[model samples]
Target: MAETSLTELLERNARHVESLDSDHFAGVEDTQAPVAVSICCSDSRVPHDGMWDVTHPGWLFTPSTIGNQVWDIHDGERVVDGSLLYPMINTRTNVTLVVGHTGCGAVSAALDAVQNGPGMVPAGIEKWVDLIVPVVEAGLNDERIDADRDVSLVDQLVEYNVDRQIEFLLESDDVPETETVYGFVYDFQGVYSDERGRAYLVNADGETDVAALRELAPTKYHDAVDRLLQ
Candidate 1:
């Protein structure tokens, strides 16, 4: 198959726009209504809309970053407080979804930086990946995690990063009290068993236990908790 050109991509988007009716976004304009804010990884395989099964526009405000990591490093960092959190706070969105995925390139890069050094990658990338040092350290220090095995450490970091981001949001005063945040790891490989299409419920309302997760999570996620947490 031939690679698609810029012209083709533009024409395709134009065709999609032309096909939309005038009422496409009828009730969504000029309002700061409650919407779902999703912070996910910048991986094309994990399409936010498709994952949520949302076909309509304006239902979800998605801000994707590398490894789906959120930080409170300082005021107005473009990735954290500027673009993603600003909109979430301004819109007063009631739910914040912090999603991480398996096989994340950013997570891999972070691991490499931790094992090797910051000089292994570009300067900008080194700093960004360094933000995840705590997560990597936690994984390395944990007795249960086998750091020698690539998959074990990578998977642990992926889930840990999601939990870490959720914790950051919960600690922030900018986040509304009415907001309910959830953390999830989108494991295309299920249960650490190489199965696919599982959304593991790692954290809910600041709780990571199976009991707390069971109370708040949908029935679909119960099995994931059991399998993945096992």
Candidate 2:
């Protein structure tokens, strides 16, 4: 970033620190017990804390990856990302949310790699993109999503990616069964019928049934509970 932009960012941080109370982080300074572990894409467009309305620090545990895939490549094998598992195993966090978004650049890149070729990218970025390629391939071949998708192919694949990540989390033997995984697509581009930033609860504990998700979600999240692909 430019020097001016970096200065502006630090100035913003200074303002934020000054705005907070001295005891804002008193309890969590020593120990943390987050309620949910959010594995979201590292997309600036997708507001992580603001979207969830999380102002407090300890309520939610945030872990972001390039495409929000739950697993990472290591020694030619896929292993669950440490950031997503540490809180689940060590802290009181039992709920896990795999949040994807419409028109995701990561999913688009993976789709391109699957359809075309792995085109030039840095080695670090290529790793995450490589992991997402299979999910794009699966979404392309899935008969259910083909029939259920109402948005563009990329947007549909975004939701499909969320499902795949949640699947990875659920199947991992290291993950506790009590840690429920919830899949959501943050619709900031009006892909779904809800409002501008409606976080659609696409899957709950691997269950993609929209009607069943309504039962699992609270009444306030009734509007947020929906599915584009059954």
Top candidate by TM-score: 2
Query: What is the C-alpha local distance difference test score of each model?
Result: 0.73, 0.88
Q: Which residue pairs does candidate 1 place in steric collision? A: 190-195
RMSD in angstroms between candidate 1 and the native structure over all alpha carbons: 3.0
In candidate 2, what residue range of length 10 has the lowest lDDT sum? 142-151
Question: What's model 2's TM-score?
Answer: 0.93
**lDDT tens digits, residue span 141-228, model 1:** 7665666655566877787777768877788777778888888777775545465655667788778887767877687656666323
Off by over 4 Å in 2: 1-4, 147-150
Q: Give the TM-score of candidate 1.
A: 0.85
Q: What is the lDDT of residue 200 in candidate 2?
A: 87
Clash pairs, candidate 2, are: none
For candidate 1, give the lDDT of residue 57.
Answer: 80
